[model samples]
Target: MPDAPAPAPVPLDRSAFAADAVTVAQALIGTTLLVDGVGGVVVETEAYDCEDPASHAFNGPTPRNAPMFGPIGHAYVYRSYGLHWCLNLVCDASQLGSAVLIRAIAPTEGIAIMRDRRGLEALRLLCAGPGRLAQALAVTGAMTGLPLDAPPFRLLPRTEAEPAIAVGPRIGLTRGVATPWRFGLAGSPFLSKPFR
Candidate 1:
């Protein structure tokens, strides 16, 4: 039999990300994140609000965090630990300074490219962290503030049948640890860190 036809790509609009960070974070699970011709299923994310101390916007919008303060459906790529670039999706209304950190994704496209970028053969290790996910998809600071509706970035809508979701506090945070903003696909081995 011929190979199955690929599923139609669904580009999400800005309205889909207009909700609060936490809500958008949970809703992002299982959605397809396409960047630079690479695709993956979002499996882990962490939400940060303007008021959260762990949030980059907690100290107000700096030059590095301008994207997080802009309209929804934009990308917020930032360098974490002065090293690898991490990808975040701007959420909430304009000036809300809310975003969801995309921590992990299950590689579904461009596996060979991702393997070369990550230097790892294990499927689950391909995009198992914020930095790794960005690197695997070739995301950089240059892509920050770009609208998701355009090329180099497109978020496919989630399926109607909800996957089992696991929620807990955000990771590696010194403050706002009580906020259960982290969301992941339950039992997914692709998770970056163990769910608390």
Candidate 2:
């Protein structure tokens, strides 16, 4: 007999994101991030809380960071260095100002769309970093505060075995340089440069 096909990834409920930043960051590994028909398996993430100086929520809520202070299970898209968009998943309770930055993902669907948007041929490069993944997935600041369970965006649960995860200090941060809160799927080639 032939092998059975795998089931589709399950869409996560709001309860799934009701945890603290570090817990949500590690838990996000292997989950699928969806934008329209395009999606990728999350491979790397970094946690941030209001207490962290490197966090956008560090000092408290601002007009630019209203989403971080709004609801859980919402998207917190933001511009970085005036160069690229970064995607973060809102976490913890309301007004808590916590989130998990999705740093990298392995492309799984809409390869053509992602490739065209990225203008890159290598599959691994399509969504290898936060900015690249946001670009490839067509995320923008307009999508900020949108519920992750709604149109043009969704989060699917990790259906496979618990991935082997690695932990280390987050990359590209000056204030929280020694904070070891970054999490990534071990052995995944589609990862951003590590903080070595």
Candidate 3:
């Protein structure tokens, strides 16, 4: 018998991101996120909102965080520690400057491209953190404000039922150390860090 065909990639509607960052972050687990056909399944995420002291938008819109204040379902790319590029998806349809940081992904597609971009052969290290994920997918500050539903970005809904999830305080934040906004796929080796 012939091999079974893969199911079509379902386009996740923008309406799915029309919620708060926390909601979107958790819901994004297990979803496949591709950038120009190079990416993988989302395994980890962190939520940020205007009211959170650790959030870039806590002090309101600035030149760097303008995308977070714009319409929902857009990309909010930023640099971390003046080195790595981090990717976030604007949420909060009310325009309150909320976004879900794509912390980590399990590389599934375009492995060769990601390996070349990252200069590594280890699959687990390819997209295990926001910086690494962005680099592997070629996400940069220039991608900010781009509609996630359009080309160069393809978000496919999880075909299987909801996967097990693990939640904990976000990492690398001094202010909101106990916000418990980080979410990841339970027991997934692709997480940036083990959930505590």
Candidate 4:
């Protein structure tokens, strides 16, 4: 017998990101994210709101974080530790400064491209962290403020039933350490770290 065909990717409506960051984060699990058709399934994410001290938007908009204060359904790409790019999906209404940080993904498409960009053969390490995920997908500061539904980016809706989600405090955060805003696909080996 032949193997079953994978379901066609469903385009996620931009309106789907109009909710708060936490809501969007939890909903992002299992969805597919592609950058010029090179990406994979979202396995982990963290929510950030303007009120959260650990969030870049906590102190209000700046030249760099202005996109977080912009409209929803846009990218908020930024550099972390001045070393690597991290990708965030702006959510909520304009000026709300809420976004979901894409932490990890299970590579399902464009594996070769991800491997070349990451310079690693380990599939698990390709997109298992925000910085690595951004690199694997070729996300950069230039992508910031761009509409997620537009070219070079394609966020597909989850075609299957929602997977079980695990909740935990966000990683590398001193403030809001106990907020439990991090969400991930329960039992997914692709997560950056195991959720406790």
Question: For residues 1-196, what per-residue lDDT tens digits would candidate 1 score against the true structure?
Answer: 9999988866888888988888899999999998987969999999998998999999998999999888889999999988999999998994489999999998999999999998989998999999889889999999999998889887888874688999998887889988888999998999998785
**Looking at candidate 1, what is the lDDT of residue 80?**
91
> Which runs of model 4 end up more than 4 angstroms from their true locations?
1-7
> Which numbered prediction scores highest in TM-score against the true structure?
3
- Arrange candidates by TM-score, descending: 3, 4, 2, 1
Better of 1 and 3 by lDDT: 3
Candidate number with the higher lDDT (1 or 4): 4
State the local distance difference test value for candidate 3. Answer: 0.93
Order of quality (lDDT): 3, 4, 2, 1
Give the lowest summed-lDDT range of ten residues in model 1. 152-161
| Local error of candidate 2 at residue 183 (angstroms) | 0.4
Angstrom error at residue 63, model 3: 0.9
Per-model TM against the reference: 0.93, 0.94, 0.96, 0.94
lDDT of 3 by residue, 1-196 (tens): 9989987877897888998889899999999999999999999999999999999999999999999989899999999999999999999878579999999999999999999999999999999999999999999888999999998999999866889999999999889999999999999999999987
Better of 2 and 3 by lDDT: 3
How many steric overlaps does candidate 1 have?
A: 0
Record all residue pairs in model 3 with backbone atoms less than 3 Å apart, i.e. clashing: none
lDDT of each: 0.90, 0.91, 0.93, 0.93
Residue-level lDDT of model 4, residues 46-152, one tens digit each, is 99999999999999889999999888999999999899999999999944989999999999999999999999999999999999999999999999999998888
